[model samples]
Target: MTPDLIILADTVHTLDDRPHHEPIQAVAVSGGVVAAVGSRSDAQSWRQAGTRVVDLGTATLTPGLVDCHIHPVFGLDLTVGVDLSGAGTLEEVRALLRTEAANDGEWLRGWGLNPNAFGTTPMHRHALDDVSGGKPALVRLFDGHSALANSRALDRAGVHGPEEFDQASEVVCDGDGTPTGLLLEAAAMELVQRHMPQESFAERKARLAGLLRDFARSGLTGGHIMDHSEESTALLQALEADGELPLRLRTAPWCMPGSGEAQWKDMARSIGTGGRRWSIEAIKLFVDGTVDNGTAWLYEPDTLGQSTAAFWPRPEDYTAAVRYFASRGIPTATHAIGDAGVHHVLNALESLAETVPADVLRRTVHRIEHIESVPDQLVERFKDAGVVASMQPTHCTHYSLADHSDNWSTRLGPERADRAWRCRDLRDAGVTLGIGSDWPIAPYEPLPIIADSQLRRRSGHPEQQPIAPAQALTALQALEGYTSHAAKAAGLWDVSGSITVGKRADFTAFEMDPLTTAPDEFAASSVLGTFVDGEIQFMLERLG
Candidate 1:
């Protein structure tokens, strides 16, 4: 039988997890699944009139990259406001905000304000007020762990001074006990965010479309969303219903600390798995905050750390939540960054391993997102418990400068800082590590991150030293993180992840072999094409 389509490439890394690698010259696709994979001659025999053939000469093909952690809806919303990503200084951030404020709007919103951009100068509400023109303005820090609100925004949110939170969140205050207009973590940030105007349904759909296109252009065929909102859920459903979704999406609705089993069952039934393209089979929980804001639940207090509280005011509630979800075959991805936070999660999983049924354990798929700082003992625990370590390589490159000078490194001091992002250790210990970009917090391209994962240095910043050079991974190992390991992490290994004959033909074609390319060249490499379910999703140009 003639195949529907044939793809020919100079080289193909199937990432099959075998002991040896083989050269794959062609792949035939029919009904969105790989029908055959062998030499170019085999595909030529199957070709006939009306069968489309795409030849990517000298280009390399691999299974499509999967970002195990991202917030597509939130990232899209960040782009609609003032993007402070490139603003190197606080003055530059203010200038950009001032320019955006000039437009007609009730409130001004912006994102990607890195506290590292401030240098020695402290961030205050007055700085944002100067550009707000008396309008309420809220600009989130790049990490999404904190935000800066102007005086008007603070007043509107009814935040006059420091407010206590059940979680580790905080409303920043001055020496005089006056509100500083900065809110740390979701609990506090939502106080001001609730006052902002809501996005219309049409606007949400447009943003979703824009986000998916961006993902395709970046060589992503699918992603796992870390958090979900009602608006995001509806928008994804609306787009898929309209046959407009371009990438596969699986999401986790946020599960707070105090929520009981009843609430968990309700969320699971109402929002889980809308269709093949959209799913909400997991729940996202925050065990602790980020390192930058000093909110991480550390083993020892950070150097002058302001927060050492767990995200859940009650730690037992977190264990119960995990148990409740795992019992019903739902996964829980806890945002655990600090060593203490990671330990808390590991303890719970270790305890539950004995009681949960083996089949349920296999299907439960519990994972820890951003295991930023962990000891050797916990790395082994991850392997023993069969938990996936969903990590972002760019977190080290984009946030920590070598020599331990960056905010993230400085917070932990030399001893603990050296253990930043134990990617190599985790992989060596047989823990499945899945890579992602954590978009909006960091750049969301797999190529640059792959380069960073291998090199342990920022792509363009050659002057900055490598962070934890010992944690660097091999190119093949890194590729597996996005392909095979990522699929295993998302519980979709049986159907996706590799270019095997029976698997779906989801692939990312590159202009060159990322595994063999020079570090500098690899970071700058562009995608030749992206395919999902045997259909071309994005292509640079037609090949003869």
Candidate 2:
């Protein structure tokens, strides 16, 4: 028999098997689909002379890790921006600004510069203003919930200052009530983002080409992309046309509809995947700001003393919006982070559930992103509602990284913090928790997440308490969070989550047994290769 590709993995984590099944070996692929799986001899039967066989030494192989909550656009933004991730203090930020400004002057692009991510005090906008001097520089607050713009950027964006829009904006004001350069929430940042140059289709194609390579290095061959912008949609079209995309891209394009099912249907249809190189299965919406932003909807009234604001329009208003998509047969993925946010969404979902059929509710797979904080009451409601709790483990571990001081914990209170990003509890409560990286916000790697879930230790926080050490998940559980279960939540169960026969031969090759490795050992383990449809995309070691 002539086969296309044969990979004799040293070990395979066949996640579908109960007893959970350890170390199976050898998989064959043909026509870009997984052909068979069995003993070495059985797999060898398909190994004709032309079959390109890869006997990957002793590396463990499994279905490609699927990150269900990443922003493909963030990766693109990072490639073109001023990066403050390496700067730890105001001085470093200034020097970075100074050096980057001296060398280049094109819209000071930067990302991952969360001063809070370094566990320090938030940098004042004046520090940024002083450095860039006259250039338009924008620094994304570590959390991605807000950003700090220099005086020039504020001017270029035509806002001058946040004081101009206090009704909706939360501009950091000095004692004098003068607009400090810091812009909170959507107030100060929207203008700059609006004015930021759009990536041409060619530039976007090249950016995605590079991003595909970046995906391979990080062990991510499958991701659910929240790329809803027009430029973003066009980029996917270009990649599909050029045949440049090499990962499982499940797109959730943004759609605005009042009620007519035809409107959403036509809109979703307009952004065609062309030939399914990608899938635009769901519609994306944000019901509240992130937990740290003090905007996640809450029911018990924020015990942390911060505002327990719901991140959506009027519940009834968005309820209709959610139902509009539901009626159109499109799955809806919402970003709801707080308990009130949960309740806000639950009430909306239940109201819609009464009109929508049970099986349709099941098929809709409406997911709540972040779900950063959940009260006991909403957990059961979430399970019964059939809502998928789309979580990012890095969000669990790196959450406090976004806080400069202990403000977030103080805001969340210790008890609620314990319940923050509760993976094990959600699983126990029967909530479908799909794990992700929320990358560039955090690295697009799973090891740190595994470390966080198991170790519960934050960088530079040997003294600071972790949000919830008790809520930690085990290694196998964390792995599953990033693998099969994640794939299931992203609506990719039929394709790539586990190494089942007849699925795509997409997978990752690893150096150590993540299941057996010591918690810290996860940091040492590396991705030898990342494969998509049996073709190696990015690899540190050769496939064979």
Candidate 3:
């Protein structure tokens, strides 16, 4: 009998343990299981009258891609106003926002620009208002840690600035205590929120659906959903029940500080995120602020010779949080970009280890996100502790600019940055390397992750050296990071990640020979068709 789908491509990297390193003449799919993977000569035997044969001339096919790390958010306001992303000077920032100010509006909202994004000229409120036609505009800092608001927004929020505001997140004020419109940290954003009401959960959920569709089109079959909230979990459940969730989602819930044990336990159970297209892998906690915001828990203060690092309420916060979830035998994934943060989270795990045996410790797999700079000793500790370094490769590519200040440079240092996303090192040390695209912060697209892993080259700003250049993975290895490695992290290693007989047929077929081509060519490659569980999904036309 002929197979249901007979795809003949020049090369099909079965992506198995010993993948088809050479070209695959044809792949026979029957009942969505790869019935035959061999030369074209035997394909005819497997083909049935109803089989659909796709001739992928000289192209390649592999398992569907998976993003291990990604934040779920809809379209940003990058195009709305003064985007300092590529602006050469602060005047350009003013000119752009000023232009947007021309539109009549009660308030302006924009995000995705760094304070130091440009080498020269910092943005100020005066410049912001000059362009605002009597409306206040809020421009969030590239890093979500901070943002800038005009006088109108500040007035609406009912605070002049940091001095007048009573909160934890730092609000940047002028030397005279006048609000400079710069809202720093989580504390400050709360003030901005007083003025701007966010979308209802239903609105956000609909937007999230759009994002999931985009993910499916990109060949992403699974991902670890961070920054998860109750509303988000409910929506995921709704999608799964409705059978509208095309991509697999692994949901991670965050624990709030000073919150009661009852609160945590209740949310954990009621989350109802797992069991369908979504998986509740662990409890996600933040040990410190992000590096961009000078909140990362570094070993020392920033290069400025001051301890700019910020920690949770206290080590006890993590201790209580981790142990609360840990005692229940649940795995935890913490946000630890700074060494201090990593050390603190590690200490929490060490505390948990005391209660559980070595064997049990391995079962309670922990993950550290965005380890920009871990000490030499910590690297070995990570291996011994059986932790998973859930890191992003693109951060180093963008942050490692030679022109950056000594503080930002020294935080990770050249040595550590050189091995930022130590994918190979983690694997060698017996630690799992789970790669992810932190969407909203980093686009959900996996091509950048694929490009960086295979080529070991930054997309732009090339002065920085490639970390663990020799540790660079091959195209197949990179593909595995998005597939098998990711599946292993989500505790779904046995179900998906491969195109084997028993595994679900959630595979993406590319239209080019990614395994045979160089990194550059693969970077430009596109997806041709996607199949998840015996059904055709997305099909993108490939460039010749």
Candidate 4:
């Protein structure tokens, strides 16, 4: 086949397991798949009159980076207001909220509010009331698992007191049973969210398109979306209608607590449904919530006695749900942060060995997202059961502290806190560990996330003490997390991941060698270009 394009880089890291004695220098693409990978002379032989050859001088090319866990569609709502991810203190949060409240709008909204900023103060409406100018205000916590609605907002939603939920959600009332304005989990947050002003479909579609382009520009060629809905599906389709998506998306629609066989069937039907660059191929479930918000299901209750319950009211039902999907050859990715949550998911997946056909079980891949603080016993079980560990290193580096002062650390106490984000341990145990930013919850930039995986702290902040130094990953492992392991996590290893003959022509070219550069230096380096399906999705003007 005549090649359509040829990408020549200074160093080409195929990252494939197959042994190759020759150093790869060029990759040829035809029909959106890698047609050849060899020396510069070999590429010249394949070059034709119509072929486009681009040389990236001194650039290092590798398999396109893929964030294994992200929520781009959900982020539209989660990031509706001023970004508070940078605020370090309660004063800083209030200052930002006040500035947002001053804007022209009937309601005040903000997101990425760190719970640690509240210090010992309770997450009450009173903190926001003074700054909201009596307007209904809602602020999403950085974890995306909870939100704090100001008094007016609570009254608007008619959340006057405690409420019951099928899932482990709460309205969080005070001693007198009055709502404190803290809403935990999706069910509770939806109560107030439904009342918030809705953005037009056109507006959301534009934002999503912009976000996906940003992903590509940051060196990502694909993402495993952890959340998907009908709206998201439609938005993706609309974006593709205008043009091809900048990055490939493997979406997993959510199957929540109140769902049953019928809902499971609906989600199964969604599988394999998507546009050219996006597809729904997996099911997303939640066993628990975030540790920072006191919603994670831990073996022992957190110091606040809040994170003891599973997101599903009946844990047995969750197991059955997994069996339902596994039997149909559908892969699942569960949001399980705490030890107990991870344990439950592992137990459910392991049960499939007895009930599911051996061939089907082998084909299906199950993943547990955010295994934040599991003990040694649970670490090996991942490899044993063949479960993928989809983790977010930034969740530890950006939110928690080494001294145990952060809310997540303090809640788990010293012992469990010391075990934070065991990336190295899991990898050492022979587990397929895929890393991500969990964007909108944390930053979506792949470079910083890959760096944080090795640094165990903010990449550029060398003065900041590492949260869990022992959990740091090697440079090669960190890159693999976003490449080979990411593909393995999504069950797409055969078609994607590494740069090799017969694989999809997706590649990320960096100005610096990611493997050899120091973590801090790599985090700041530029992405020369990103290609998906043999087409350049993002490239520096100079490169173009």
Q: Rate the local accuracy (lDDT) of all candidates.
A: 0.86, 0.69, 0.66, 0.93
Give the clash count for each candidate.
0, 11, 11, 0
Per-residue lDDT for 1-544 in model 4, tens only?
A: 6999999998999999888778898999999999989988898899999999989989999999999989999999999988998888899999999999999998999999999888998888999999998899999999898999999999899889999998999989899999989999999999999998899999999898899989999999999998888899899989989999999999998888888999899889889989998999999999999887888999999998879989999999999999999999999999999899999999999989899999999999999999899999999898999999999999999999999998999999999999999999999999999999899899899999999999999999999999889989999999999999999998989998999899999999999999999999999999999999999999999989
After best superposition, candidate 2 residue 330: deviation in angstroms?
Answer: 1.2
Worst 10 residues of 2 by lDDT: 160-169
- The order by descending TM-score is 4, 1, 2, 3
Best lDDT goes to which candidate?
4
Off by over 4 Å in 4: none
Tens digits of per-residue lDDT for model 3, 113-228: 65554443444566576666778678876556677788887787887745432223666677888877766666676776666646676766677777787888777766787666
- By TM-score, the best candidate is 4
Q: Give the deviation of candidate 1 from the true structure as CA RMSD.
A: 1.8
Total clashes, candidate 3? 11
lDDT of candidate model 1 versus the reference: 0.86
Which of the two, 2 or 4, has more lDDT? 4
Write the residue-wise lDDT of candidate 1 on 36-90 in tens digits: 8877887879898999999998899999998888888877656558888788887
lDDT score for candidate 4 against the true structure: 0.93
Q: In terms of TM-score, which candidate is stronger, 1 or 3?
A: 1
Instruction: Give candidates' CA RMSD values in order.
Output: 1.8, 3.5, 3.7, 0.9
Better of 2 and 3 by lDDT: 2
- Determine which window of 10 residues in candidate 4 has minimal summed lDDT: 16-25
Where in model 1 is the C-alpha error above 4 Å? 18-22, 270-272, 542-544
